[model samples]
Target: MDDYPVHQISEVVRHVGTSDRNFYDRYYFNCAPRFDGQGQSGVDGPFALIIGLGQYPNLGVADAFAVLRRGDDHLVVRASKALGEDRMDTSVGPFRLEVIEGLRRLRVVLEASPDNPDLSFDLTFTADSPAHLEARHFDRSLERVTFDTQRFVQSGTWSGSVTVEQVRTPVEDHQWSGNRDRSWGVRPVGEPEPPGRRADPAETERSCFFWIYAVLRFSEFVIITILQEDADGARIVEDAVRLWRDPERAPETLALPEHTLRFAPGGREVTHAELVFQRRDPSGGLADPLRVECTPAVACYIGVGTGYGLEQDWRHGMWQGPLTVQQLRRAVPEIAPWERMLCPVDNLVRCTLSEDGGIEEGEGLFECAVIGTYPRYGFHGLGDVAE
Candidate 1:
């Protein structure tokens, strides 16, 4: 398969295993071109990622990044040994280590090798350089490694509040029989409640309605890779950039258009962007999970920012989603005593930045204000936000 085009990777589900790490056996990278940096290298492929559950591939690939660079050609190394467990003869007095430049850097706190505890290497590279990273770079003499990204890769860093909001669509539920009468043919009925069609009595409900919300917020910057050309313009990348705060350093910014950046002969700012937050719901549960059809898909606006070029307001719930308490009780008439509270996201309370670093009033009232909030879970009644 060495003759296969690099693009063919996506066409086939290649299998890789982990000897040292514990998670993914195969990883996938969705490659795209962007003038977003130092023009296209035409040689270095974009930093595609582990296609699985996003744990190990990030680690192994990041680990492999330390050894390869833009100019190295046909470098065959062992991935299982560099990432996998102790298959190599470590008893031979500490394994050899090599440092390469124009590569990537990872912070190490304590050394691991039994023979060489103080092993340290300063892997320095440009802000974002094109480097070929694969686990096999560290140990070369072996073929077909037991490659698993989880076995060797460690999670990255995390900081800030920038986030991504996916649009939710309203799907149809087969549960909707549409008849106002009970499917059981109960003769006398007052208001029109949708017919219940549950095969088992336990599955039936009078009506099931819940709130779905999304918000936009700022987040920390983790990985920022950029390249400067001698006379050409600059290009900016979104996903390859890292977050310094989170353990995984996963790029909070999703994929965006490739941009051509200019350095003014030679210049770009050394940046550190801080994150702020807003909210609708952060728990990340689907608005509706039972339906089977092409539902609505729009960007969530609950936590968005103007600077980031995301001001999407999904079609549903744009105008007056959940209303006052009177409407809720009137809708079902099942629980009259339950009161609703609407506590606004008060900036005064949520934004008092003291040296102690805590919100004084953001933890405002749940019961005192009688605000316009209608909580659905755990707190069916009022006094849930704890004032």
Candidate 2:
């Protein structure tokens, strides 16, 4: 469907993880474009999807291109999650065995196969002639059974999978270690307090906030963040991190100042370095103000003389997808109300990312767009009238 409105993806959410550790949630906010690089031509396509998660550090998706012959009316998708682990991950392939004559469904199956077959498929509507407007229904039953077998299999990491599609020419970034910042940077100053203790302070609340540190990695590619408050509040931050050689780099072999930040899951980064403060106020009041107090007040890359930097590419953005609102409403009636909520997840929201791991049709900031799909959603990112 051309410029079909955004489908309000509603899902029963489930969270699993330790209390202190980073947590994640599953929401329908993930969305991709409807029609992709299928040439510049398009009629109304189908409601498609490429889902994703927020702050999910480890999950990734892989797919393959296959054309089923006219003989076998069915296909199976099965695969392993971590290759050598007991945890077999699978997805609910997005199609089912249909009896209709001449129907095509391209599935971006999920990874909950064998055990829980739950994923989505993009079905293009076709008929003997152009006059057939009859709609298709979303099949919960087909969603029930997984091929329990046929999965688009590939090797290597997330970036590798992109190469399989032969659609990406990655740009990487690198940096040196010899010029490491001996000081790892500091936090903002705390609130002022009295040197002496006074009398009648009433009921007070103690608040404790985490100085959250995020390390995002896809296989061998990683991005680290150690956030602190804007001490001077001038919209600038300076960062200095001490660097040291673990194996003691040979001045002859290893490049001077070249620091390696493994992007793989267990790759290491300095985590949980922080300072805590306790305030004893006579007046019963709130807890101490919690703000990142960075010594320099900003985050920056102080490239030493080596002039080296980390690998390049933000490694963010989505792939293309197709989905018509009218088609979706016909497919799954549960989303009837969502038809009214057809808008970006955020008001100033500029883009939408799908979970199936593709860049669905949507837009945001002027530069805000899926790398190539250039999804042609209505101008506002959704609706009947193009934005």
Candidate 3:
């Protein structure tokens, strides 16, 4: 084990993460076909496909899922398995996630299985921009530390194919563009509440905010923005926005990005936003602003399908013990019905941005989870309403 390559060694091998029950490491990405015409496509056709893999070290389990939204259909498949001591092995049944060339490139494979015969993918992602790390301090509470948290965002292109419902769609380099993020930290994972009991509002308040993260790729640059606001839409706990010009050539760096987000009537969804890029003068005065206008087209409610804190059967790392591939396959169908009924991708928005007076359109993945109150996204009765 000592002789193993640095990239091949997993964090679990070194016990590097915190002892928090919710500690998790995850990989998430969204891919879609390149827009052909000008402006935003407006969610008229096949939207996007999202894939994720998460490892909960303390709980001794790992899980993976894939969701494809084609036209009016939303198809999803999930699998989970016990995490063995060998962290180097990143395969969970038919799903296998591997780093082919460390941060620069990685591969994901989902072989055909009895439970999800119509869905499988063999895709490789090559990073187009250097990974940009987000600020770690998210919550206001100092005592309840979300420890050892690290996140890196990258804009990348996908190459390979994904089969959905017996249809194989090839994703050539530059033809299908997307962004990926790697996050590892103490987050809520696994079954937090007793089976069939509603989660307490106080417990849910830990993450009671609406988060919007959009990564837009253009001909010359890339724009990444992240915003997190509290339950009453008062405090902005996390605000990170940046631009990378010709990211393919230069090393990634952080810059001050000023922006305003305007949501729709209910304040649950973003309708329009204006991002201004500026630099401070030597004397601390603001410089001329470079402006961009963004209009949302489509989005996905991430929690709906991923099951972050929703259900016991869908929770990450809920797998109890060592299981065979066939047994895992058999378990998927039992949860498939629940996935369809409860999990809906409400906001996977395809967006259009006007930058430098040119209308450049692209597809982006966005999600909002309002835990305590009546969120405008129609998740009213899902959980107990906080007072």
Say which candidate scores most in TM-score. 3
Deviation (Å) of 284 in candidate 2: 52
lDDT of each: 0.19, 0.18, 0.63
Residue 307, candidate 2: Cα error in Å is 44
Q: What is the C-alpha local distance difference test score of candidate 3?
A: 0.63
- How many clashes would you count in candidate 2? 82
- Model 2: per-residue Cα lDDT over 180-299, one tens digit each: 000101111111224232222221111111112222112222112222122121112112121122224211111111111111122111111222222223484544421111111111
RMSD of 1: 27.8
Best by lDDT: 3
lDDT of 1 at 116: 23
Could you report the Cα RMSD, in angstroms, for every candidate shown?
27.8, 25.0, 5.8
The ten-residue window of minimal lDDT in model 3 covers 324-333
- Candidate 3: list runs displaced more than 4 Å: 1-14, 38-44, 140-143, 146-148, 194-207, 232-267, 275-278, 281-283, 324-363, 370-387
Candidates in order, TM-scores: namely 0.16, 0.19, 0.77
